[model samples]
Each structure stands twice: as C-alpha cells, then as structure tokens.
Target: MNTRLLAVAALSALLLGGCTDTSPGGQAVRARHEHFEELGKAMKEIDGQLKADTPTSATVRVAADKIAELAPRVKTWFPAGSGPQDGKRTDAKAEVWTRNADFGTAATRLEAAAVALKAAVEGGDAAMVRAAVKNVGAACKNCHDAFKTD
Candidate 1:
C-alpha cells in the first residue's frame, strides 16, 4: 500500500508539471507580450502629456523614465522559439530570430533614445523634450517595422 501511494504521488507530480506550459517558448511569448504592453502604456502616457498645450513635466519625466528602464530588458524578452511560428499569438516576425544582430541593434537604439528622453525631460525644456520624444518614437518604429507584424 505504501509503495503504491508513493508511485501515485510521483505520477501526479509529473503530470501536473507537464500540464503547465513552462517551456522556454511559452515563457518567452508571455513575457515579451507583457513587456510590449507595458512599453505601449508608457508611450501612450508620454504622448498624451506631450500633446497637451501645457504639459506636466513631472508626468512626462515619469513616463520617460519607465520606458528607459524597460528598454534594456527588451532584448531579453525575445528568446529563441518565441516567434509566431511557435504556435503562439506573438506579433514578432521570424526575422527577429534570423536577424538577431539587427534586432539587438534596434533595441540598443531604443535604449539610447529612451535615456536621451529622460535626460531631456530632466532639463525642463519643452522643446528638447519634444525632440527627444520624436527620436524615441523613431527608434521604436525602426524596430517594429523590421521585426513586428500588424
């Protein structure tokens, strides 16, 4: 009876573990999706502030800082086997994996732009902030155009 109980318990553990989609591809898909969503929210908040006639510098700085923090982690979010072909609903194109070096460069550009935006915001100059925001947007567009799908 004791041996049977132990065998049943071990089998149950294995089955439960297998049921969870903890595979690298599954984890990467979920993480990258979440990261992009966060980035989108931050960008939207910053854009809203920028569009205001009398934008709040503090709010803009906060949103820009969030983007700066997330930028570097963007590279890590797209691990191997996380593309659309992995039977996932990701918008990431297969070219992201094939042209990984270019993807890394694009991520670096976004990081640099995000850092610049944060610094511009700190300077309390509206014109500088606007220019930095445009740079950041361009960096994002460059990557999305190459590696992402609509």
Candidate 2:
C-alpha cells in the first residue's frame, strides 16, 4: 500500500510539472524561457551565416529582432537579491541576486545591442553589423564575467 501510494504521488508530480500556475509572473517567465531559446538559436544561425559570407541580411534582421525581444526577459529567470544559489536548474550565479540592479542593467544593455543589430543587418551595413555584434558580445561577456563560473 505504501509503495503504491508513493508511485501514485510521483506520477501526480510528473503531471503537475507540465502545467505551470499561469500567474502573470509565471507566464512571463515561461515566455522568457521559450523566447530566449529561440533567440539563442537565431543568433547562432545569424553568426554562422555571417562568418560564411553567405548571410541573407533579411534573415539576419529577423533573427536579431527575435533576440532583441528576448533580451528584456533575461531578468525573469533569476531570483533578484536572493543570494547565490546552486541547484540543478539554475544558470545564474548568486551574484545575480546579490547585484540585482547590475544584472538588470546588463540584460537591458543586451536588448539595446540586439535592437541595434537588427537595424544594422536590415540596412545591410557591414560596419554597423560588426559594431552591433561586438556590443552584444561585450554585454554577454560582462554578464558572464560577473555572475557565472565554468
């Protein structure tokens, strides 16, 4: 009877995990997670195209826009001011919570860089694309430097 009850409880949890609470914040975080995945995929595709000299500027623009959309969502994944935590599901360092404002600023700057990248690619301006990509990279590196470990 105890073993059966335990099995039933485990199954229940599996089903429950599929359904988020759907609160505004929950919705937001879900959106952010999905969008971030999309954005990362787009960036890799765009970078590959660029490096290969076969980029479709229009495609790059679309991808960059998608990434821009995800940039603001970066803050939703971490617990702000909650101290560094370690677990199976987090990519964030405790510094994200310890230095919440700085983390937020880094996220915001990434968004701005994405927007710039979108414009640059859409305009088919190589110089602008390079600059924007560099800016975006700097933002990523800065955030990683402050809040992540290998």
Candidate 3:
C-alpha cells in the first residue's frame, strides 16, 4: 500500500509539472512579463495621482521611483532566446532580436525618461511632473510600437 501511494504521488507530481511551461526560455519570458506588469502598475499609480483633485506628492514620488528602478533593467529582461522564436509565451516582437540596436535605443530612452521623471518628482513642480510623465509614456509607447505585438 505504501509503494502504491508513493507511485501515485510521483505520477501526480509529473503530471502537474508537465501541465506547466517547462521550456528552456519559459522562465525568462514569464519573469520579463511580470516585470512589465509591475511597470504598468507604477504608470497607473502615477496616472491616478495625476487625476486626483490634489495629487499626492508622496504617491507620485513612489511611482516615479519605481519607474526609475525598473527602467534600467528593461534591456536585461529580453535575453537572446527568451522570445517567440523560442516557443515562449511572450508578446515581444521578432524585431526585438532582429533590430537589436533599435530596441536598445528604445530601452535607453525609457531609462532616460524614467530618470527625468524621478528628478521631476523630486523637484515637486506639478508641471514638470506632468511633462516627465508624458515623456515616459511616449518612450514606453515607442518601444511597444516597435517591439511588442500588443
């Protein structure tokens, strides 16, 4: 009876593990997607604060700092094999690899925009914050347009 139970547990573990993505690049794709989602959340938080009648400086600062922290790491998210060609579930376009230079430029632009955003937040000028947010959004859009499927 104990032998049978052990066999069943082993089979169950194998089945469950098979149900998940065990591809070579799957983990990298998932991790990059998660990072992008976090960046999106920070962007939304900034937007929410902007929409508020009296925008919260602390909230903006926190969100802007998050962008600053994440932007520099954006390039590392897409390793060579972590794309659609590797059969990983990702929305990153083929151009990311094919046009690597352009993608790098876009990533650098986002990093610069994020740094500007952090500076703007520190400056505590509403107009500068708004402009920095606009620049950051534009940088994101540029990359998404060139390198993302959706």
Error of 3 at 83 (Å): 0.8
C-alpha RMSD of each candidate structure in angstroms: 6.5, 4.4, 5.5
Best by TM-score: 3
Worst 10 residues of 1 by lDDT: 12-21
Considering lDDT, which of the candidate structures 1 and 2 is the better prediction for this target? 1
Tell me each candidate's TM-score.
Answer: 0.82, 0.69, 0.84
Per-residue accuracy of model 3 over 1-150 as CA lDDT, tens digit each:
699999998777666642366555667787887899999999999999998833447988998889999999999988877788765567899789999999999999999999999998888788888999999999999999999996
Better model by TM-score: candidate 2 vs candidate 3: 3
In candidate 2, stretches whose alpha carbon ends up further than 4 angstroms from where it belongs are 1-35, 79-88
Taking all chains together, the TM-score of candidate 2 against the true structure is 0.69
What is residue 141's positional error in candidate 3, in angstroms? 0.4
How would you encode candidate 1's per-residue C-alpha lDDT over 15-57 as one tens digit per residue? 6642454789877787777788888898888889888843446
Candidate order (TM-score): 3, 1, 2
* Model 1 bad stretches (over 4 Å): 1-21
